[model samples]
Target: MNADNITSDTRSELPQNSSADAAGEKTLKKVANRLIPYMFSLYILSYLDRINVSFAGLQMYTDLKMTDEAFGFGLAIFFIGYFLFGAPGNLAMEKLGARKWISAIMVVWGAITMALALANSIHSFYVLRFFLGAAEAGFFPGMILYLTYWFPERQRGVAVAKFMAAIPAAGVLGGLISSKILEMGGIMGLPGWKWLFLITGFPSVLMGIVTLFFLTDKPESAKWLTDEEKAWLKGEVEKDRLKAAAAKDSVKLFSRETTGSLVLLSLLYFSLTLGMYGFQLWLPKIIKGFGGLSDGQTALVTVLPAIFQALGMIFIAKSAERTGERKLHVATSAFIAAAGFVLTSLIDNPWLSLVTLSITAFGIWGTVGPFWSLGTSILPARIKAAGIGFVNSTGNLGGFVGPYIVGAIKQSTGSFHYGLYTMAASLIFAGLLSFFSERLLKKGTRIET
Candidate 1:
């Protein structure tokens, strides 16, 4: 169907009662107002904990007497645990409930993160990082699945955009905080890098405790919502579920179409993540390479790209929602990011390199909302949790590959140019695949949303 037809069909499904529509809007606002803040906070902390190691690596590499490859392996190993546990962890969340499962994951990961401070050797660092990955494996996909319970298809893009904005928020805030924290060396005879992990990991524990009481698993269990509001929300969700069931011939865990979609989505995510982590983990070092900059100066410079990235993510997601188009938004973002990566590699000027890096950050980060919306929108409700888990787990393998490849190439070639070029190619491939995947999905499954 055409865009106009899709919009019209969507409109036809809306409630006829203006008063009810207003009431529903108010209820949704209330739900979002209550839920989004806590979720956003939790995600920021989660992201910070996961990536603070990059900042720590600025000094910890020399402190622990580690090589570039060893540090890269440490970064990559976290994803191994993440990849292994993703699907099962998500399924466990489905069985055990989000409140309990998410809180548990947070608490355990928080402890593991704190313990990272005590690591005095490369082996211990690897072990701690691996466990940290295992502890935090399902949190992202689990949160995605959790949002599906609260928001319908039409609203999910905005909801997810706001939530995922935490990525860049973590980057900006975490960078600033980590820079200062790194200045705390010899405060207690411990290095600033040790203090970085020690301080950042505690919030997750507190947030986990807050989540236990603050979050509700489903709309039905939320006491803040009235009976009328609950009924309206649940009714709307039920309509989506029934529609998904009716649209698919079978909602099995593994079907040909579903599996194909998952694999494509995985590759798409792999490419994007390669750029995301490669930039994130190495940006500080990249900035430092320009010379004549302190660690604090490098950290502050990293904040600009994240700020722009957050803006790009929110703007692109809102546009995707306004246009009711997912595939093109994702493809275009990837293409823009690919160009940015390519340019960053070729540019010789430091200022120009920073601008290009910002563009790369914008493109890779911008893809998050529309990409998830596209994946989740077409997934069968029956297997959404598991399917999302599978896609996330498989895709995150890129997290491992991205840093490792960059490190390996940097070591071998003695320059980051080759790594940036490789990531650009990956992004270009992803953009092309996303463009073609839209047509394939439309032809094969009659996907509308």
Candidate 2:
């Protein structure tokens, strides 16, 4: 059956035949090609802006005469605003639509990031970081929710993964570029960290403006898609929603099972996030501690883990999609991450440490797609927005805790070993919790992949 033979006028009468199935596959590919690269690029900019502070700290901490504890506090405060606003911000996206709300988010956060270059005191650092978190609150979870509006349940793991591959991509790119930017301290009489902020922040603002014109809100409104493709894609998504609705035992927002699943997922994400940010936010400094390495050398070393992470995450998610499983993948990845963390803490050889960090990055990031796939499936549609928001917001508290604890431990003990051990324990807990979480989720309500 030739997909091209399908026409708009015959759309309704076109049976659920092989031709339509082929058309749907082609349509999904078209959507992926059209959206994913652009979405991937946007996320790269978004994550680069968020994590560049890790690199900037090498210079900024010294210039400002800040303690490790104080610097960690500044990093942790961003998540406070992020936690407070995540749910509300997601709800706002639901009302205002992704196009407007996401654009606004990017613009505000970009401006705050640029403003970070002006920080002269710890007080200013704390204030700007908090506002930066508040400004960027819903962008990540909002992108997750936004993907749901396009892709069906089975396809989300790959879609979410491809989008999230940006995290490591950002890490890799930010390291390479930021390392050079840090070398530019005397350029225009401003320090290198200031240059890093200015360079990284401006692209987001430009991309935010582009998003207003570039992004299509939903398939029904996508002009590039033929009416036949649009109808078929929308029908596919609606079928998934209908199946979810029919299978749900209770449609209520606050059902006991629903609430329980949300809580458990939140905790699971908390552990995963703690390990993620703990490693990511401290990676450059961790490498710098190896001795005799310059900032550029430290940044280059940091890129290796991110490269492994980028490759591992995409491959893991794609494999999970093929196997049509999410739970075990997440648990397995978490366990691997725990092992990596433990090994990294114990290793003294710099090269061996880098190898372990790569393993750690691979394992921690490999869980992202499967985790989100499992999460959205467990939560009922009625509570999805708020449920994801609650999970992400509460879970992100770990971001604060991870960096702060690692910093404080480094301050008191003068080593990251205990901090790495703490993160490993949390990952193990997350791995164990995944099995229990699957049990707590309602049997029928879960969207079958």
Candidate 3:
């Protein structure tokens, strides 16, 4: 509970840099270097696992002859289970700690994903989605819990942004992997979709196992941190906690403040995700509109945005870390994403459309790093896990709404344009919300909590 207990300083005495800025910078670089890779890997693979279904969606649609509603319901069902566990999962991450809880969640979800290879009908898909959602429920929240253990208040935006670099990164990885799997679909008495499910699920199993040994729950738990650094961090955080509480404004992670963050985040996330999720679900089909690429080419093209996204994430995360602020990074990223969506919706030229799409991917992925960091920063460690859990679980509703909404729009209008416009609007709303949120936060409202 004491901040002194959680410091990562390298000395028995705190650094005497004579300036807070210098010491904080050293800590930022040190922590970022140490944790970024592991965080990045975990995030990329975890996200890949979550959205692998989208990659498989095209094939599944063909094999199952899924109606628009049927597919949407199935996609949305994942979040139903995801939402149910929001509070519990984060609390579990906090009480049980990330190492054990996350490992268990990974194993369960991986195994569940592996089981998807057996799905035979819509009924089976629905069942699998429910279980998959339940299994995957805690992973995101577990990540938030994990981060609060390592990052300080000022550094949180960049710290979280780095971890979140995986969203679009997943897109790239998913596309490549999906393409390969699609290629392998007919080789071993299975369809490409089957291969996608099997290959994607296997990583969850492998990563879950790897993380047990590799990941630490907190800096305090790291044998690497110096005693003085640990003490100083503890003192620093506790100082803030006391100040917050004495001001009758305790920043507990699961309080009303956090709920406020969850609301704005979920709303913003919903709109952004609408564009993202719908885009992912129907992208191959949209590319098919170009009428030039083969199914394989379509899948491959789908992967390019992910690469742009990964690069964007890395750039913005490091930038935010250096700047020690999130507003500009987040707002800009959101706006960029919105622009990309708009371009894709309006541009009739294929190359230009794809380029715009990739740019949007860059923005979305770039902004996500800061989005989550901003979400977690206002809260304290105790409920940090749960707060983020609530955020992710709720935000996933956008995931549910996106694909279905897109499909419905497409079906009704007989063009992807309507659906695309719907998605763009979502992105714009999210951007505006982020702008307002930043302003509110600067005034100490924590409205974006």
Best by lDDT: 2
Q: What lDDT score goes with residue 79 in model 1?
A: 85
lDDT of each: 0.79, 0.80, 0.69
Candidate rank order under lDDT: 2, 1, 3
Candidate 3, 1-449: lDDT as tens digits: 00000111011233356665566556656767877788788767667777787768767787988876677677767767777775688788888778888888888888888788888899999999888888777776567556656665555545554465566667777877677677776776888888888888888888889888877777677666677666655666566456545644444544554556556766766666666667666677777677787566778888777688778767876676666666567778878877887778788899999999888778876766566556555544556544554555556677778877777766677777877677777877777887788464435664232
Of 2 and 3, the candidate ranking higher by lDDT: 2
Q: What are the models' TM-scores?
A: 0.87, 0.86, 0.78
Model 1 spans with C-alpha error above 4 angstroms: 1-14, 152-154, 238-249, 253-260, 322-328, 373-389, 438-449
Badly placed stretches (over 4 Å) of model 3 are 1-14, 17-35, 151-158, 217-266, 311-336, 369-393, 434-449
lDDT of 2: 0.80
Relative to the true structure, candidate 3 has a C-alpha RMSD (angstroms) of: 6.1
How does candidate 3 score on lDDT? 0.69
Q: Which residue runs does candidate 2 get wrong by more than 4 Å?
A: 1-15, 152-154, 230-250, 318-328, 373-386, 435-449
Lowest lDDT sum, 10 consecutive residues, model 1, at 1-10
- lDDT: which is higher, 1 or 2? 2
User: TM-score: which is higher, 1 or 3?
Assistant: 1
Estimate the Cα RMSD of every predicted model relative to the unseen true structure: 4.6, 6.3, 6.1
